[model samples]
Target: MEQAELPSPPSPARLPWDFHPALTEERLRLCGRMLANARRDALAMARYEMGDDPWSVGCRAFAFGRNRLQRAASSGDYPWLEVLDDSAHFVFVIGGNGNGVPVRFYRGAADEPTERTLRRQEMEVQQLSLALGETEAEGLAFRLAVET
Candidate 1:
């Protein structure tokens, strides 16, 4: 009789974003739409600062685990999405909303945002919260204990 080999375990990095329990398609779609709104709003802000159309300006948004330093297993199943401006001056986190329909927001990004940048990001978050039919405080907290 021939011996059979066991299948190797899945790579940590190969895991899909939807592997997170709360990362539903609906939520991801909502996040993307909200990020687009944020980007469009930022274009106006950028125009206000630079006095131009900012037609070429853009931003990037993506999903990531709660704790970037830790393995996915240790990071829990909640998903966090980030939207960062092209200038790298502004960024914000759309935290897990749990059973709620509104998305949450938090400070910080790949590049450290300055006080002025953070204040601008806060204004966007406040607007987003109101648009989502929830108060900023209601969607303010992170879902998992893991720090981002």
Candidate 2:
């Protein structure tokens, strides 16, 4: 199905964000749907440690924008979106893997990661910054950290 494209959102940099430790199943289902039909939405997710710590955490964030039915065939950015459960603290969206749509959210403060799992991610962010210049980089939707 061809899902509608969501409207634009605020610059991720301007918003105050924090690390989201975990996402619950109930919340995921509720918010995942919310994102699909939202007027404005941009979200990010990541996996890494918090500066010299053993705690590996998953992160998700929702910017001010909108999302509809995004699928691999329909949208390269967010494929197989099942549900978006949005809440005060976090917004949960599910993306299908071979097993199911794994729910993740983008929340608070995250240092540019040094973890090797996302080694390329940091490099890409740098390249984007260099290519677009700092101000322009902030405008691009893809500038937000995207995790799968």
In terms of lDDT, the poorest run of 10 residues in model 1 is 60-69
- Residues 1-148, candidate 2, lDDT per residue (tens digit)? 9999998986675321111112334434444444432312322222234342222222112333223333322455544334333332222233344222223333222345324322233333443355445575453322122332
Which residue ranges in model 1 land beyond 4 Å of their true spot? Answer: 1-18, 48-148
Q: Provide the global lDDT of candidate 1 against the true structure.
A: 0.37
The Cα local distance difference test for each model comes to 0.37, 0.34
RMSD of each: 14.8, 17.9
After superposition, the stretches of candidate 2 with alpha carbons farther than 4 Å from their true spots are 1-79, 97-101, 107-148
Best by TM-score: 1
lDDT of 1 by residue, 4-90 (tens): 999999776521133233445655555444444555455545544554443334322112221231222234553444432222333
Give candidate 2's error at residue 136 in angstroms.
Answer: 39
